[model samples]
Target: MSDATLMLSGIEKSYNRGTPGEVSVLRGVDLSVQRGEVVALVAPSGAGKSTLLHIAGLLDVADTGRVEIAGQDLTDLSDTRRTATRRADVGFIYQFHHLLPEFSALENIVLPQLAHGVPRAQAQTRAQDLLDRVGIAARADHRPAALSGGEQQRVAFCRALANEPKLLLADEPTGNLDPETSDQVFAALMDLVRGTGLSALIATHNMELAARMDRQIRLEAGQLIPLGGAQRPA
Candidate 1:
Protein backbone atom coordinates (compact mmCIF):
# COMPACT_ATOMS: atom_id res chain seq x y z
CA MET A 1 0.00 0.00 0.00
CA SER A 2 1.12 3.52 -0.78
CA ASP A 3 0.45 6.78 1.08
CA ALA A 4 -1.57 8.48 -1.63
CA THR A 5 -5.08 9.43 -0.67
CA LEU A 6 -6.32 8.67 -4.22
CA MET A 7 -4.60 6.98 -7.10
CA LEU A 8 -5.74 5.82 -10.55
CA SER A 9 -3.48 4.11 -13.03
CA GLY A 10 -3.97 2.92 -16.58
CA ILE A 11 -7.70 3.47 -16.27
CA GLU A 12 -9.91 2.77 -19.26
CA LYS A 13 -13.64 3.12 -19.73
CA SER A 14 -15.94 2.92 -22.73
CA TYR A 15 -19.62 2.61 -23.41
CA ASN A 16 -21.28 0.28 -25.93
CA ARG A 17 -18.15 -1.75 -26.21
CA GLY A 18 -17.70 -3.86 -29.37
CA THR A 19 -20.23 -1.74 -31.15
CA PRO A 20 -20.02 0.85 -33.89
CA GLY A 21 -21.21 3.63 -31.58
CA GLU A 22 -18.76 2.95 -28.80
CA VAL A 23 -17.42 6.00 -27.00
CA SER A 24 -14.29 5.91 -24.96
CA VAL A 25 -14.20 8.25 -21.98
CA LEU A 26 -10.98 7.37 -20.23
CA ARG A 27 -7.98 5.76 -21.84
CA GLY A 28 -4.91 4.91 -19.85
CA VAL A 29 -5.50 7.80 -17.43
CA ASP A 30 -3.18 7.91 -14.46
CA LEU A 31 -3.07 10.32 -11.55
CA SER A 32 -2.37 10.45 -7.84
CA VAL A 33 -3.56 12.79 -5.14
CA GLN A 34 -1.56 12.94 -1.93
CA ARG A 35 -2.95 13.26 1.60
CA GLY A 36 -4.04 16.80 2.46
CA GLU A 37 -3.29 17.87 -1.11
CA VAL A 38 -5.96 19.53 -3.23
CA VAL A 39 -5.84 19.01 -6.99
CA ALA A 40 -7.95 20.75 -9.58
CA LEU A 41 -9.12 18.82 -12.64
CA VAL A 42 -9.88 21.18 -15.50
CA ALA A 43 -11.67 20.19 -18.67
CA PRO A 44 -14.35 21.27 -21.06
CA SER A 45 -17.99 20.32 -20.67
CA GLY A 46 -17.92 17.24 -22.90
CA ALA A 47 -14.59 15.98 -21.60
CA GLY A 48 -14.33 12.88 -19.41
CA LYS A 49 -14.10 14.78 -16.13
CA SER A 50 -17.19 13.25 -14.56
CA THR A 51 -16.24 9.79 -15.79
CA LEU A 52 -12.83 10.06 -14.16
CA LEU A 53 -14.36 11.41 -10.94
CA HIS A 54 -16.92 8.61 -10.73
CA ILE A 55 -14.17 6.06 -11.17
CA ALA A 56 -12.06 7.73 -8.50
CA GLY A 57 -15.00 7.98 -6.07
CA LEU A 58 -15.92 4.35 -6.69
CA LEU A 59 -19.40 5.35 -7.78
CA ASP A 60 -18.46 3.60 -11.02
CA VAL A 61 -15.70 1.29 -12.14
CA ALA A 62 -13.07 1.38 -14.86
CA ASP A 63 -12.99 -1.23 -17.56
CA THR A 64 -9.35 -1.75 -16.69
CA GLY A 65 -6.67 -0.50 -14.30
CA ARG A 66 -6.33 0.43 -10.69
CA VAL A 67 -8.44 2.56 -8.36
CA GLU A 68 -6.94 3.12 -4.95
CA ILE A 69 -7.85 5.31 -2.03
CA ALA A 70 -5.93 5.71 1.20
CA GLY A 71 -3.47 3.17 -0.19
CA GLN A 72 -6.09 0.44 -0.67
CA ASP A 73 -6.59 -0.87 -4.20
CA LEU A 74 -10.32 -1.08 -4.90
CA THR A 75 -10.41 -2.12 -8.53
CA ASP A 76 -10.66 -5.79 -7.69
CA LEU A 77 -12.99 -5.50 -4.68
CA SER A 78 -16.45 -7.01 -4.79
CA ASP A 79 -19.28 -4.49 -5.13
CA THR A 80 -20.15 -4.82 -1.45
CA ARG A 81 -16.56 -4.36 -0.36
CA ARG A 82 -16.07 -1.42 -2.73
CA THR A 83 -19.16 0.27 -1.35
CA ALA A 84 -17.86 -0.27 2.18
CA THR A 85 -14.55 1.28 1.24
CA ARG A 86 -16.29 4.25 -0.39
CA ARG A 87 -18.40 4.90 2.68
CA ALA A 88 -15.37 4.63 4.91
CA ASP A 89 -12.83 6.58 2.86
CA VAL A 90 -14.41 8.80 0.20
CA GLY A 91 -16.73 11.81 0.38
CA PHE A 92 -18.42 13.17 -2.74
CA ILE A 93 -20.22 16.35 -3.78
CA TYR A 94 -21.92 17.32 -6.99
CA GLN A 95 -23.37 20.42 -8.68
CA PHE A 96 -26.78 19.78 -7.16
CA HIS A 97 -27.35 19.91 -3.41
CA HIS A 98 -29.32 16.63 -3.46
CA LEU A 99 -30.47 17.14 0.12
CA LEU A 100 -33.51 15.27 1.31
CA PRO A 101 -36.53 17.53 0.85
CA GLU A 102 -38.12 16.52 4.15
CA PHE A 103 -35.05 16.57 6.36
CA SER A 104 -33.84 19.59 8.24
CA ALA A 105 -30.38 20.84 7.24
CA LEU A 106 -28.79 19.37 10.36
CA GLU A 107 -30.57 16.06 9.93
CA ASN A 108 -29.44 15.86 6.32
CA ILE A 109 -25.87 16.17 7.53
CA VAL A 110 -26.36 13.79 10.45
CA LEU A 111 -27.93 10.94 8.51
CA PRO A 112 -24.79 9.79 6.73
CA GLN A 113 -22.85 9.74 9.97
CA LEU A 114 -25.57 7.69 11.57
CA ALA A 115 -25.48 5.24 8.68
CA HIS A 116 -21.73 4.97 9.16
CA GLY A 117 -22.39 3.91 12.78
CA VAL A 118 -21.76 7.23 14.47
CA PRO A 119 -23.76 7.77 17.63
CA ARG A 120 -26.82 9.99 17.19
CA ALA A 121 -25.65 12.50 19.78
CA GLN A 122 -22.15 12.64 18.31
CA ALA A 123 -23.47 13.00 14.78
CA GLN A 124 -25.75 15.83 15.78
CA THR A 125 -22.87 17.60 17.50
CA ARG A 126 -20.66 17.23 14.46
CA ALA A 127 -23.40 18.42 12.12
CA GLN A 128 -23.91 21.56 14.18
CA ASP A 129 -20.20 22.20 14.26
CA LEU A 130 -19.94 21.82 10.49
CA LEU A 131 -22.80 24.23 9.93
CA ASP A 132 -21.06 26.69 12.26
CA ARG A 133 -17.84 26.36 10.30
CA VAL A 134 -19.74 27.38 7.17
CA GLY A 135 -21.41 30.22 9.11
CA ILE A 136 -24.78 28.52 8.77
CA ALA A 137 -25.48 27.25 12.26
CA ALA A 138 -28.52 29.53 12.39
CA ARG A 139 -29.91 27.80 9.31
CA ALA A 140 -29.25 24.27 10.56
CA ASP A 141 -32.84 23.65 11.53
CA HIS A 142 -34.29 24.90 8.26
CA ARG A 143 -35.18 22.47 5.51
CA PRO A 144 -33.58 22.77 2.07
CA ALA A 145 -36.62 24.56 0.65
CA ALA A 146 -36.09 27.44 3.09
CA LEU A 147 -32.40 27.95 2.36
CA SER A 148 -30.75 29.82 -0.47
CA GLY A 149 -28.63 28.15 -3.10
CA GLY A 150 -25.34 28.82 -1.35
CA GLU A 151 -26.70 27.70 2.00
CA GLN A 152 -28.04 24.45 0.55
CA GLN A 153 -24.70 23.67 -1.03
CA ARG A 154 -23.03 24.36 2.28
CA VAL A 155 -25.30 21.85 3.92
CA ALA A 156 -24.45 19.34 1.21
CA PHE A 157 -20.79 19.95 1.95
CA CYS A 158 -21.38 19.25 5.61
CA ARG A 159 -23.24 16.06 4.77
CA ALA A 160 -20.41 14.88 2.57
CA LEU A 161 -17.92 15.44 5.39
CA ALA A 162 -20.09 13.93 8.09
CA ASN A 163 -18.56 10.49 7.77
CA GLU A 164 -15.01 11.89 8.08
CA PRO A 165 -13.69 10.42 4.85
CA LYS A 166 -10.01 10.75 3.97
CA LEU A 167 -10.65 11.86 0.38
CA LEU A 168 -13.19 14.34 -1.08
CA LEU A 169 -14.28 14.27 -4.71
CA ALA A 170 -16.37 17.12 -6.09
CA ASP A 171 -17.81 17.59 -9.56
CA GLU A 172 -18.59 21.21 -10.37
CA PRO A 173 -19.99 21.73 -6.89
CA THR A 174 -20.65 25.42 -7.52
CA GLY A 175 -21.64 25.14 -11.14
CA ASN A 176 -25.28 25.85 -10.40
CA LEU A 177 -24.64 29.10 -8.54
CA ASP A 178 -24.36 32.63 -9.77
CA PRO A 179 -20.87 34.08 -9.83
CA GLU A 180 -21.11 35.83 -6.46
CA THR A 181 -22.74 32.91 -4.68
CA SER A 182 -20.34 30.48 -6.29
CA ASP A 183 -17.35 32.34 -4.95
CA GLN A 184 -18.74 32.42 -1.43
CA VAL A 185 -19.68 28.74 -1.50
CA PHE A 186 -16.35 27.71 -2.94
CA ALA A 187 -14.52 29.66 -0.24
CA ALA A 188 -16.54 27.99 2.48
CA LEU A 189 -15.74 24.60 0.96
CA MET A 190 -12.02 25.37 0.77
CA ASP A 191 -11.93 26.53 4.37
CA LEU A 192 -13.70 23.42 5.58
CA VAL A 193 -11.46 21.10 3.54
CA ARG A 194 -8.23 22.79 4.67
CA GLY A 195 -9.28 22.74 8.31
CA THR A 196 -9.80 19.00 8.11
CA GLY A 197 -6.59 18.23 6.18
CA LEU A 198 -8.48 16.14 3.64
CA SER A 199 -7.25 15.34 0.16
CA ALA A 200 -9.45 16.51 -2.73
CA LEU A 201 -9.80 16.12 -6.48
CA ILE A 202 -12.26 18.71 -7.75
CA ALA A 203 -13.40 18.93 -11.37
CA THR A 204 -14.41 22.35 -12.64
CA HIS A 205 -14.67 24.46 -15.78
CA ASN A 206 -13.89 27.58 -13.78
CA MET A 207 -10.23 28.40 -14.29
CA GLU A 208 -10.14 30.96 -11.48
CA LEU A 209 -11.14 28.37 -8.92
CA ALA A 210 -8.80 25.78 -10.40
CA ALA A 211 -5.85 28.13 -10.02
CA ARG A 212 -6.48 28.32 -6.29
CA MET A 213 -5.88 24.62 -5.78
CA ASP A 214 -2.45 23.31 -4.74
CA ARG A 215 -2.01 21.53 -8.06
CA GLN A 216 -3.86 21.35 -11.37
CA ILE A 217 -4.26 18.64 -14.00
CA ARG A 218 -6.13 18.55 -17.26
CA LEU A 219 -7.70 15.75 -19.25
CA GLU A 220 -7.12 15.81 -22.98
CA ALA A 221 -7.75 13.06 -25.50
CA GLY A 222 -8.25 10.59 -22.66
CA GLN A 223 -5.04 11.30 -20.82
CA LEU A 224 -3.96 13.21 -17.71
CA ILE A 225 -1.56 16.08 -18.22
CA PRO A 226 0.14 17.79 -15.30
CA LEU A 227 -0.03 21.57 -15.42
CA GLY A 228 2.97 22.30 -13.25
CA GLY A 229 4.18 24.99 -15.63
CA ALA A 230 0.85 26.75 -15.78
CA GLN A 231 0.68 30.17 -14.17
CA ARG A 232 -1.39 30.41 -11.02
CA PRO A 233 -2.14 33.28 -8.69
CA ALA A 234 0.59 34.08 -6.19
Candidate 2:
Protein backbone atom coordinates (compact mmCIF):
# COMPACT_ATOMS: atom_id res chain seq x y z
CA MET A 1 0.00 0.00 0.00
CA SER A 2 1.87 3.03 -1.28
CA ASP A 3 0.61 6.61 -1.48
CA ALA A 4 1.30 6.94 -5.15
CA THR A 5 -1.57 6.19 -7.45
CA LEU A 6 0.88 5.37 -10.24
CA MET A 7 4.65 5.02 -10.29
CA LEU A 8 7.35 4.16 -12.78
CA SER A 9 11.00 3.90 -11.89
CA GLY A 10 13.99 3.56 -14.21
CA ILE A 11 11.73 2.41 -17.06
CA GLU A 12 13.37 1.44 -20.32
CA LYS A 13 12.06 0.09 -23.60
CA SER A 14 14.03 -0.99 -26.61
CA TYR A 15 12.91 -2.56 -29.84
CA ASN A 16 15.02 -5.05 -31.75
CA ARG A 17 17.10 -5.23 -28.63
CA GLY A 18 19.91 -7.36 -30.02
CA THR A 19 19.72 -6.49 -33.70
CA PRO A 20 21.04 -3.77 -36.00
CA GLY A 21 17.60 -2.14 -36.15
CA GLU A 22 17.39 -1.80 -32.42
CA VAL A 23 15.73 1.41 -31.22
CA SER A 24 15.47 2.44 -27.63
CA VAL A 25 12.44 4.52 -26.64
CA LEU A 26 12.71 5.03 -22.89
CA ARG A 27 16.03 5.35 -21.09
CA GLY A 28 15.59 5.03 -17.34
CA VAL A 29 12.42 7.11 -17.25
CA ASP A 30 10.87 7.80 -13.88
CA LEU A 31 7.38 9.22 -13.20
CA SER A 32 4.97 9.33 -10.33
CA VAL A 33 1.33 10.42 -9.94
CA GLN A 34 -0.63 10.90 -6.76
CA ARG A 35 -4.37 11.03 -6.07
CA GLY A 36 -5.92 13.84 -8.19
CA GLU A 37 -3.28 15.56 -10.23
CA VAL A 38 -3.01 16.16 -13.96
CA VAL A 39 0.47 15.85 -15.40
CA ALA A 40 1.11 16.57 -19.04
CA LEU A 41 3.55 14.39 -20.94
CA VAL A 42 4.92 16.23 -23.96
CA ALA A 43 7.33 14.85 -26.50
CA PRO A 44 7.89 14.92 -30.20
CA SER A 45 7.28 12.06 -32.60
CA GLY A 46 9.82 9.21 -32.20
CA ALA A 47 10.53 10.37 -28.68
CA GLY A 48 8.60 7.26 -27.55
CA LYS A 49 5.61 8.99 -25.99
CA SER A 50 3.22 6.25 -27.03
CA THR A 51 5.63 3.51 -26.09
CA LEU A 52 6.15 5.03 -22.66
CA LEU A 53 2.40 5.40 -22.21
CA HIS A 54 1.74 1.79 -23.17
CA ILE A 55 4.34 0.64 -20.70
CA ALA A 56 2.82 2.82 -17.99
CA GLY A 57 -0.65 1.42 -18.61
CA LEU A 58 0.66 -2.17 -18.51
CA LEU A 59 -0.38 -2.53 -22.12
CA ASP A 60 3.25 -3.26 -23.02
CA VAL A 61 6.24 -4.52 -21.07
CA ALA A 62 9.25 -2.37 -20.49
CA ASP A 63 12.70 -3.76 -21.18
CA THR A 64 13.84 -2.88 -17.68
CA GLY A 65 12.73 -1.18 -14.45
CA ARG A 66 9.44 -1.36 -12.62
CA VAL A 67 5.83 -0.17 -13.05
CA GLU A 68 3.51 0.08 -10.13
CA ILE A 69 -0.17 0.98 -10.29
CA ALA A 70 -2.13 1.82 -7.16
CA GLY A 71 0.92 0.70 -5.23
CA GLN A 72 1.01 -2.88 -6.61
CA ASP A 73 4.21 -3.82 -8.44
CA LEU A 74 3.30 -5.27 -11.82
CA THR A 75 6.68 -6.73 -12.77
CA ASP A 76 6.15 -9.79 -10.60
CA LEU A 77 2.52 -10.39 -11.45
CA SER A 78 1.32 -13.17 -13.70
CA ASP A 79 -0.07 -12.24 -17.09
CA THR A 80 -3.62 -12.93 -15.97
CA ARG A 81 -3.11 -10.93 -12.83
CA ARG A 82 -1.60 -8.08 -14.77
CA THR A 83 -4.55 -8.04 -17.11
CA ALA A 84 -6.92 -7.94 -14.16
CA THR A 85 -4.96 -5.15 -12.54
CA ARG A 86 -5.11 -3.10 -15.72
CA ARG A 87 -8.83 -3.64 -16.06
CA ALA A 88 -9.65 -2.57 -12.52
CA ASP A 89 -7.05 0.09 -11.76
CA VAL A 90 -6.28 1.81 -15.03
CA GLY A 91 -8.60 3.76 -17.34
CA PHE A 92 -7.39 4.51 -20.85
CA ILE A 93 -8.53 7.08 -23.41
CA TYR A 94 -7.02 6.95 -26.86
CA GLN A 95 -7.09 9.56 -29.61
CA PHE A 96 -9.41 7.57 -31.83
CA HIS A 97 -12.20 6.84 -29.38
CA HIS A 98 -12.33 3.06 -29.83
CA LEU A 99 -16.01 2.44 -29.23
CA LEU A 100 -17.77 -0.60 -30.64
CA PRO A 101 -19.51 0.31 -33.88
CA GLU A 102 -22.65 -1.67 -33.27
CA PHE A 103 -23.25 -0.78 -29.67
CA SER A 104 -25.09 2.35 -28.60
CA ALA A 105 -23.10 4.80 -26.52
CA LEU A 106 -24.76 3.48 -23.37
CA GLU A 107 -23.89 -0.08 -24.26
CA ASN A 108 -20.33 0.89 -25.03
CA ILE A 109 -19.94 2.54 -21.66
CA VAL A 110 -21.40 -0.42 -19.76
CA LEU A 111 -19.59 -3.24 -21.55
CA PRO A 112 -16.29 -2.96 -19.68
CA GLN A 113 -17.97 -3.17 -16.34
CA LEU A 114 -19.94 -6.21 -17.46
CA ALA A 115 -16.72 -7.88 -18.53
CA HIS A 116 -15.37 -7.26 -15.04
CA GLY A 117 -18.31 -9.19 -13.51
CA VAL A 118 -20.59 -6.33 -12.55
CA PRO A 119 -24.22 -7.28 -12.97
CA ARG A 120 -25.92 -5.88 -16.04
CA ALA A 121 -28.46 -3.87 -14.09
CA GLN A 122 -25.87 -2.29 -11.83
CA ALA A 123 -23.56 -1.52 -14.70
CA GLN A 124 -26.38 0.04 -16.65
CA THR A 125 -27.20 2.35 -13.77
CA ARG A 126 -23.56 3.34 -13.45
CA ALA A 127 -23.25 3.91 -17.18
CA GLN A 128 -26.31 6.13 -17.18
CA ASP A 129 -24.91 8.12 -14.33
CA LEU A 130 -21.61 8.61 -16.10
CA LEU A 131 -23.32 9.69 -19.29
CA ASP A 132 -25.32 12.25 -17.38
CA ARG A 133 -22.30 13.58 -15.58
CA VAL A 134 -20.39 13.92 -18.82
CA GLY A 135 -23.31 15.86 -20.35
CA ILE A 136 -24.04 13.06 -22.79
CA ALA A 137 -27.15 11.51 -21.31
CA ALA A 138 -29.13 12.75 -24.25
CA ARG A 139 -26.70 11.12 -26.61
CA ALA A 140 -26.46 7.83 -24.77
CA ASP A 141 -28.47 5.94 -27.36
CA HIS A 142 -26.48 7.23 -30.30
CA ARG A 143 -24.21 4.73 -31.93
CA PRO A 144 -20.76 5.64 -33.15
CA ALA A 145 -22.10 6.07 -36.65
CA ALA A 146 -24.79 8.43 -35.42
CA LEU A 147 -22.85 10.61 -33.01
CA SER A 148 -20.75 13.60 -33.90
CA GLY A 149 -17.02 13.28 -33.37
CA GLY A 150 -17.24 15.19 -30.11
CA GLU A 151 -20.16 13.13 -28.87
CA GLN A 152 -18.35 9.95 -29.73
CA GLN A 153 -15.35 11.12 -27.78
CA ARG A 154 -17.55 11.97 -24.84
CA VAL A 155 -18.88 8.45 -24.82
CA ALA A 156 -15.37 7.13 -24.98
CA PHE A 157 -14.46 9.22 -21.96
CA CYS A 158 -17.44 7.83 -20.08
CA ARG A 159 -16.42 4.29 -20.93
CA ALA A 160 -12.88 4.88 -19.70
CA LEU A 161 -14.19 6.08 -16.34
CA ALA A 162 -16.85 3.39 -15.81
CA ASN A 163 -14.68 1.37 -13.47
CA GLU A 164 -13.63 4.26 -11.23
CA PRO A 165 -9.95 3.61 -11.91
CA LYS A 166 -7.29 5.38 -9.92
CA LEU A 167 -5.11 6.21 -12.91
CA LEU A 168 -6.38 7.68 -16.18
CA LEU A 169 -4.02 7.50 -19.11
CA ALA A 170 -4.93 9.47 -22.22
CA ASP A 171 -2.97 9.60 -25.46
CA GLU A 172 -3.71 12.51 -27.78
CA PRO A 173 -7.35 12.43 -26.86
CA THR A 174 -8.07 15.70 -28.64
CA GLY A 175 -5.86 15.22 -31.65
CA ASN A 176 -8.71 14.27 -33.97
CA LEU A 177 -11.07 17.07 -33.06
CA ASP A 178 -11.36 20.59 -34.39
CA PRO A 179 -9.97 23.17 -31.99
CA GLU A 180 -13.37 24.19 -30.64
CA THR A 181 -14.58 20.63 -30.32
CA SER A 182 -11.36 19.59 -28.69
CA ASP A 183 -11.79 22.30 -26.11
CA GLN A 184 -15.29 21.12 -25.29
CA VAL A 185 -14.28 17.50 -24.93
CA PHE A 186 -11.30 18.38 -22.79
CA ALA A 187 -13.36 20.65 -20.62
CA ALA A 188 -15.83 17.87 -20.01
CA LEU A 189 -13.03 15.48 -19.17
CA MET A 190 -11.53 17.92 -16.68
CA ASP A 191 -14.88 18.46 -15.04
CA LEU A 192 -15.65 14.76 -14.80
CA VAL A 193 -12.26 13.61 -13.55
CA ARG A 194 -11.36 16.62 -11.45
CA GLY A 195 -13.89 15.97 -8.72
CA THR A 196 -12.65 12.43 -8.23
CA GLY A 197 -9.01 13.50 -7.94
CA LEU A 198 -8.00 10.78 -10.40
CA SER A 199 -4.30 10.79 -11.19
CA ALA A 200 -3.82 11.43 -14.91
CA LEU A 201 -0.87 11.43 -17.25
CA ILE A 202 -1.77 12.65 -20.74
CA ALA A 203 0.41 12.91 -23.83
CA THR A 204 -0.33 15.54 -26.43
CA HIS A 205 1.56 17.59 -28.96
CA ASN A 206 -0.61 20.64 -28.39
CA MET A 207 1.03 23.19 -26.13
CA GLU A 208 -2.33 24.81 -25.44
CA LEU A 209 -3.55 21.61 -23.85
CA ALA A 210 -0.27 21.07 -22.10
CA ALA A 211 -0.52 24.52 -20.57
CA ARG A 212 -3.65 23.39 -18.77
CA MET A 213 -1.79 20.76 -16.76
CA ASP A 214 -0.10 21.03 -13.36
CA ARG A 215 3.40 20.29 -14.65
CA GLN A 216 4.75 20.12 -18.16
CA ILE A 217 7.70 17.90 -18.97
CA ARG A 218 9.17 17.49 -22.42
CA LEU A 219 11.05 14.49 -23.73
CA GLU A 220 14.23 14.78 -25.74
CA ALA A 221 16.94 12.31 -26.71
CA GLY A 222 15.48 9.55 -24.54
CA GLN A 223 15.13 11.77 -21.50
CA LEU A 224 12.72 14.22 -19.89
CA ILE A 225 13.53 17.93 -20.03
CA PRO A 226 11.64 20.35 -17.85
CA LEU A 227 9.64 22.81 -19.94
CA GLY A 228 10.41 26.56 -19.53
CA GLY A 229 13.81 25.78 -17.99
CA ALA A 230 17.07 26.81 -19.60
CA GLN A 231 17.67 25.09 -22.92
CA ARG A 232 20.10 22.19 -22.74
CA PRO A 233 23.03 22.03 -25.12
CA ALA A 234 22.62 20.08 -28.36
Q: Give residue 214's lDDT in candidate 2 (0 to 100).
A: 73
How displaced is residue 12 in candidate 1, in Å? 0.7
Please tell me which predicted candidate would have the highest TM-score against the true structure.
Answer: 1
Pairs in clash, predicted candidate 1: none
Per-residue accuracy of model 1 over 1-234 as CA lDDT, tens digit each? 566999899999999999999999898998999888889999888789999999999889899999888877789899999889899898999999999999999999999998999999999999999999999999998999999999999999999999999999999999999999999999999999998999999998898888888898999888898886233233
* C-alpha lDDT of all candidate models, in order: 0.92, 0.87
**Which lDDT value does model 1 have at 169?**
96
lDDT of 2 at 96: 98
In model 2, what lDDT does residue 75 have?
A: 75
In terms of lDDT, the poorest run of 10 residues in model 2 is 225-234
Off by over 4 Å in 2: 228-234
- Model 2 per-residue lDDT tens digits across residues 1-234: 567888999988899999999998889988887677787889888899998888889899988999988777897777898889999999999999999999999999899999999999999999999889878898888899999999999899989999989899999999999999999999888878885678898999989888877777887777777674222112
